[model samples]
Structures are given as structure tokens and as C-alpha cells.
Target: MPFYRFDHAPDPVEKAGFSPEEVPRAITAIGADLVAGMGLKEMGVHFHRKAQLIFTLRGIVRCEADDGVWIVPPRCAVWIPGGMPHSAALSGAVEIYCLFVDPDAAPALPAGCCTVAVSPLLEQLLRHAAHMPVMYDEDGPDGRIATVLLDQLARAPVEQLNFPMPQDPRLRRIAAALMADPADRATIEAWGKRMAAAPRTLTRALTRETGLSFGRWRQQLHILIALQRLDQGAAVQSVAQELGYESAGAFVTMFRKALGKPPARYLAERRRQDGNGAD
Candidate 1:
């Protein structure tokens, strides 16, 4: 099934007796055991009411919020802000390792949810953390591991997969419509007529809400849809046609411009990177 909306799950922290503040050190201590216990199909959510860093050791996990959705593949992690309602859906089976960081450790990270590329050292550290017990003594190996994990987390590279929120109701309405059918080729005037707003008003809303013109926003939406499809193993040509592009060449051009690489190249690089690591 297509994942289009954010679904709330029951709070697992309360049941597990784990607080967000302690999740980082806790996970660093019990990293391996947690991965072995929670199979990929088992969905989990931590209301990390404190800014937290979650690492994905294997497989892909999809995160959805009111603003956008993120596909966190192997060797990539997500930084989720405290109190942001987000849920994850794992793809197939996964090792699913994670580390939660205390807010004080990384104050500069985004308060909202975003994905980051994990380094090989960080991946190894998190995998090692899975074996330790939660709340382990700070003086023990787990405590030392936790300290290194925090250092690595601070240096992880942030990927550009963010979709900012559209605050204007008028622009939001247009965004929702575009998301519903990414292939829509409606002109600004046509969309304005459908929304019962003047074309100028719609233009202003697009610029204000998303910092992108209608053309740019549409392109971004198309690229996002393409990424989702590619992750599912959709053929490039088929995906292009499905997205209303004239040809695969046209789609590749747009994707390269948006992501700085062609789809096949991007996939190959990610696959190669995954093969070399804990993923």
C-alpha cells in the first residue's frame, strides 16, 4: 500500500520504561540485542521528546510527518526533534540498529526530522552498542562506546532529502493536490481556477510557503515520487512515463538536476556503499 499519511502509534517508551533523555545512552549500551529482538517488520516509535539521533544499520525505513516523508536506507540515520509526531515503516527485513542522543550533545541539529549519512566508524560503533545493557555503568565499555557514538553523531553528514512545510492554506491546498497526482500538468491559471484563487495569489503562496516557484516545487515533487518508485525497483523508463515525462532522458535530466546524479548512478553508489558496511 502507498504511504500517504502519518499514522500515530501507541507510545512504546511508556511501556518499555525508557525516557527520551536516556534513550541515547540506553541504546548505545544495548544496540546489538535490540536489533536481534526487533525484526524489521516490527514497527516502533520513540517520541524522543528530546532531540535524538537514530541510526539505520540495515534495510530501509520510511518516516512520515505532516510536512514530508523520508526513506532512510542502510548506513543512513534520521535526526528527529522532540515532540514531532513521526512513525516509521520498515522495508522488508532489516537489522534496524539505532542510537538516541541527548539534546545537549547536539544542539545545532534540526529540531524537525531529517535524514543523515552515517560513517563506517559510526556504523560499527552502533552495532557494537547493540550488545550492551540499557543504563549500563558510565565507567564500563558501554559508557565509553556511548561517548564515541555521540562524537560520531555530531559529525555525520546531513543529506538533502528534506521537504519543508507549506504554511499557507492556499499553497498547502495546491501542494496536497500535487501530491495526490504528481503527473498533473495543470498550469498556474488552471490550478488557480480550481482553487478559486487568483493566479497571482497562488503564485505568491507558492513562493512564500515553500520558497520555490510552481515549476520548481512540481519538479521536486516529481523527484520525490521517482525516488519512492525507484526504491521499489520500478524501471526508469516506466517511472518516467508514469510521471508524465516525455522520455526517460527527460526524467533523468530532471532527477540529476535535483539530486546531482542520475537514478542508476545514485542507486549503484548507494548499493556499493551498503555492501561495504554493516548494512
Candidate 2:
């Protein structure tokens, strides 16, 4: 697996440049050389010429785009549209299965960054795609695999695992503080006072910038960081407390609410799809 490293990015030491001529007419999968749990300290925001699926094969990878940051666990993929600047981090041991698809070749792929849920069938298809030669026959078995993959990707559920970051300086300050310590469950009024901004002003900035109210925005941050910690093998109770949850059950409820499953159940399923249980 070879990962393209681009020189345009000051970080993510690994990069490569590709043009449409460099890729297949449809989808091309490159077994990216991502190590388990190793991340580029900082990969300056960059984009791909082709829409990319940063699919996690093992462990977790966290990525940040212009709009938000997402923690991608096993069997989870971050779908980034072509030309969308984004950067990624490997919080823990993480392996990547990269798929680059031309929108002209597969119109069903989303034009924005999204967290895609990988079904069992889709995962297998992606596995096959990863092993495909750079120039696979479009009219052959690989072509059929690519076709099914597009359908699966198009039909895959869009999961709410991303936390959109606010761009306003004041809001960024507030967001930064909360992300530093999700357990700091302070009131908006209190936070505003600490930041020397009016509560009303803070609320307006948060809503206008991120389209998320102050409270919802904080919860979103909590979700993003909590997933990172949990994926690193933290105990549920500890993670709950770390994120300001009253108990493990409270954290589980929130996790289920946002992602439709508790940490244990989710990780179990991840492991099952991760080739530990079955192919």
C-alpha cells in the first residue's frame, strides 16, 4: 500500500500528487501506508483531486476539515469530496484503506465531507477494492466490484460523528476552552464572563458561525473528544466522567442518542467488521 504525500502540506509527511490521468476512469483504491496509531502531528489542510474515502481498517483516525473534526473508528470512514481541504490525525494505532473516486465517474458520492457508516457487505467490497490494481479493467470483475462499491457508498447512512468547528475568533476561544476540558460544564453566562464577552453576544456568535447553539456546540465537542478517548481503550466510566457525564450510563445514553449505540456495542461491532470475528 502506497500513500501519496503532498509537499503542499507542511505536515502529514506522506503526500503525493495525482491528476485525473493518474487515476482510473472510475474508482481507484490505494492501500495507504498508515501505521496503527501513528499520526502526522499536523497536516496542513489539503484536498484531493478525487473524492476520497479515509476508511479506518484498524484503530482510529481523527480528521479535521474546514467545517469540523471527526473521530473515525474501525469500520467507519470519512468521505471527503474532491478539492475539499482537510487534515488528519492518528490518535492511536490506525490503518487506512484509501479509495479515490472521480465524481464524474460516480455521481452518487457526496460533494461534502461526511462520516460514512460501513456495512458488512460494503466493508468486504472496500477490502476487495483496496487490493485492486491501479489500472483495473472497467469491464471486468474489478469493475463490478467498483460499481457495487459506489452503490454501497451512496446508500450508506451518514452518521453524526463530526463536530463542526466555529470559525469566529470569540467562538473559537470558547470552543477551544471547552475542548480542553469537556468536564468543565460551565454555563454560557459564566463562560461569556470568563471570555469577557456578553452572553447574548456569545450565543449569537456561536449560532451564526457554527449553526449550533452554545450548549449543542459544547456537546458536539464533548462527543468528538470522548470518542477519541474511548477508542484509545479508556473505560466507559472514566470516559463518561472525563467528558462531564454524571455516570457511565449517562455517557452511554448520549452516545446512543448521537450514534445509535453504546460504546461497548459499537466497539464490538467494529471488531467484528475489523476481521477479528470474520471476514
Candidate 3:
């Protein structure tokens, strides 16, 4: 419910005099206080530019950053690069834990935000780091956990779930319409008519702006919608119908072709991996 802001980097290093060993302890205290009054479901948006790793203990959270959008479900956390603008929206009540690390220590991490799967070992490590004093010795359990968290972060895999936007106004309008009704199933001619552009011109615009033909763009839109529904826990049959697929089988094929996995399997894997650490 309450949003707290921490700007550690701005404070003078000598006056603040916080030792690197105490980082985990400070992180733990912050995590405990954040969860004290609110469960996962009650957590609100908390944004910071400082490099940090956020792990979800339960529930899901949506994060939007400069690089792209991510769905952070339980056991998953998002690694945000220093200076990247990012924000979080709770998907449901969840126990969200975090570790703010010095960017210099994690050189293998991406320079931008990315979602990472958190292993069970990493989860416990984070919990341990949450309580260690801000100035504790680096040889302690807190320090070891910090070292492991950084290692897990380096080995984390990034998943892509972003749909790039077209900048051209003509293509943008058509894209907007498709997003508004993913089940429209309109041909290029029909969409061109609605947009007051010649079908040929519309096709060229789409190709130029998105590097995809009209049909491909529409298919991608459908896939995007299907993924959104799946993330929200919709059944494959229902999602297929909602997206105007002729049958669940057709939707499965499309999902498989686009993402290399069936809808159910993809969603299940996402849930399982996300519970471990996904963004």
C-alpha cells in the first residue's frame, strides 16, 4: 500500500559508510517491511533505477521497462539494469522479495532489464540475504548468498514476449484496429477500405513499417492475443474461439508454429518456470 523510495547511490559513500558486506542485510530488512502489512495480492507499484533483482515468493506481477514488458510470476524475478526506467503492476496478491546489488559486481548481466528464472536454491539465498545486516562481513551466509544470486543472474535465460509497435501513422492505425479486435479476421482489402488507403499502399506501409506482410502481421496479432489470454489462465479452446480460430486444433498449430510449443504446454511451462523465477 505504501510506496518507499531508496536512493542509495546519491548518498556520499564516506558519510553513509555502508560496507558492501551489509548489502544483503539491508535488502532483507527492506523485503520484510514490504511484506509485513501486505500479502502478494496487496503489493503495489514500486519503481527504482538502481540495479536490482526482484523475486516473487507468490502470485504474479507485471513489469514494464525500457527494453520490454514482462510478467513476473511466483518464484520468478526481474533483473533491472542500473538507470533503466521500470515499473511494476501486481497481477494478484503475491509475496515479492528483492535484492539491490551494486551494478559493478554483476558484470555478466545485460545492460537492460530482463526476466530470469529463480531456482529454489536462489530463492532461499535471497531469503537469507534479506535479514543479514547492511554492514555484515562478506564471508558470512549473507555474503555467500549474494555471490550465488549474482551467479544465478549470470546464468539466467531471457525470454521474449514483446510486440514491437509500428511508427508509420497508416500502419499504426491498422495495427491499433487489429489489437482492438484480434478476432476481426479482416482481409487487407477490408482494412484498407476502412483506413481510406489503397490496398497496395497499405501492404507497402505494413512491410515498410513492420517488415511483415499484412497477413503475417495479423497472425502475429492473433498470437499476441492468445499469449495474453494464456497468461491470464484461459483455456486453449476458449482462447482459440475468442481469437476466431476455426478450432482448438488450429489455434494449437498456430501457437506451436509461432512459439515452438503448444498453448497448454507453453502456459504450463511458463507457470512452472515462473514459479521458480520468471519476469
Candidate 4:
């Protein structure tokens, strides 16, 4: 669903613990574990005064903001800047940690929505921060921990998990249709006919709005879906077939080409990292 209205309520920190602004500290970390079948599945469009880092050790969290959708897989976090309207959806069983930081607390952090790699130390910091008092002393050891957390977060390497969404209404329709049925292996010409536009016009408009060609953009969506599905424990063959790939090998080739690793290796590496620090 597209973001329509801005939600004027407390930030998501309230679900895990306390609200971010109620505390006098620069950051507030809270953790929540959501299992499948829970009544909660999506968060409405919302914005807050503090920036947020949505990190997950298990399952997946997808956030939409800044005209793009970002997926937080294992060992990564999606960073949403302060006052940027956004919404999030959770899949499967999710153990997520959200850290809300004052806008001015970390000058080095990215000022936009992006996914960043979470190191073992950074993951532990967030996990530990969740247990900290809402009003941690700025001059004490907890304060020092907060300083380290911010430092690590600032230096966290960004990942390429952002799927830019086109703003044009026609392009948005195409995007929505493709996301709804990823297995639809239609060409640009076919999509153009479906959208009542010339293939060249669709191509040019998509490239102009998203900086990616039609094929690349479609493949990007496939990659994002593949990542989310793999993270959810779907088998490679099933995921490949589900995405309309002729065979699992074809899907592996595409995944390896796009992500620099095959599905099994990529997921294994992430699970290794998680096992190293995950409780």
C-alpha cells in the first residue's frame, strides 16, 4: 500500500518499551519479537523526531520510505532518517531491535534511508542497549556504551538492499503489478501494452525516474524477493520456481551475479555471523 497520511502518534519504541522522546538521553533502544500469526503485520505511515535503525537477527523487516523499499535481512539494518515518513512490515518470526537516536546525535550517520551492514559488535551493542535504562547517565559507563554504539553505527558499511520505486503513476502501477506477481515474466513491450504506453516511453520514463532500465529494475525486484524468501527458510528450488525461473540453477546464477554469492553461501554466511553473536 502507498503511504497516504502521516501518523501522528508515538514512535514504534513504545511497542518494545518506552517512547523515544520521553527519555532525556540521545538514544533509546527497544527490542520486540514478533511471531507469525500475530495480529500485527504492518505499521501505518508514520514519522518521528528521531532517526531509527531497524535491525533483525531473525526473519525479515521491509520498510518503505523516501520513495523506495528497503529490506533488512539477517546481519543488516535499515536506517531511516529523522522526520522521514515511513512504514514497515514484518515477515515470519522476527526478532527486531529498534534504536531511536536524536537527529543530531550522530553527524556521520547517513541522512537518508538505506540498509547498512551490522557487525558483530554493533549487533551486540544494540542488543545490550535494549536492556539499558531509558535515562542512562550521559557521564557514566552506559553513556560510554552509547558513544560506542553511535560510533559503530556511523561507520557501519551501507548495503545495496534499496529497491527504488518510480514516482510516475504509470510506473507505480507497473511496479505494483510486478510486486504482486513476480512470476509474471513479461517483457517491457508486454508491460507497455498492459499500461497503455509505448515500450520506449515506458523504458525512458522508468530509466528517468529510477535510474534503472526495465529489465534491471525487474531483476532488482526479483533479487529483493529472493532475499526475503531465502531468509524465511524457503528452499532454493522452490524460491526459484516461485519467481518464475526455469530452474534452480538459473536462479542461482542470477542471485550469484547480483549479490556476488549463491543463495546457500549467502544465507550460510549470514547465519554464521548471526550464530557468532545471536542469543
Clash count for each candidate, listed in order shown: 8, 12, 14, 0
- Top candidate by lDDT: 4
Worst 10 residues of 4 by lDDT: 1-10
Q: Can you tell me which runs of candidate 1 are displaced by over 4 Å?
A: 1-47, 54-75, 85-98
TM-score-sorted candidate list, best first: 4, 2, 1, 3
Question: Would you list the C-alpha lDDT of every candidate in the order shown?
Answer: 0.66, 0.74, 0.63, 0.83
Candidates 1 and 4 compared by lDDT, better number: 4
Q: Please tell me which model should have the higher lDDT, number 1 or number 3.
A: 1
Which should have the higher TM-score, number 3 or number 4? 4
Q: Which 10 successive residues of model 2 have the least lDDT summed?
A: 5-14
TM-score of each: 0.75, 0.83, 0.64, 0.91
User: Where does the lowest 10-residue lDDT sum fall in candidate 1?
Assistant: 1-10
Instruction: Give a tens-digit lDDT track for model 3, residues 110-204.
Output: 87676676676676667666555556577877667667767876786675443335666777676667666778888889877888889998888
Cα error, residue 19 of model 1, in Å, equals 4.9
Off by over 4 Å in 2: 1-21, 33-41, 269-277
Error of 3 at 86 (Å): 3.1
Please list the residue runs of candidate 3 whose C-alpha ends up more than 4 Å from where it truly belongs after superposition: 1-47, 54-60, 72-77, 127-137, 166-233, 267-279
* Model 4 pairs in collision: none
Give the per-residue Cα lDDT of candidate 1 at 38.
50
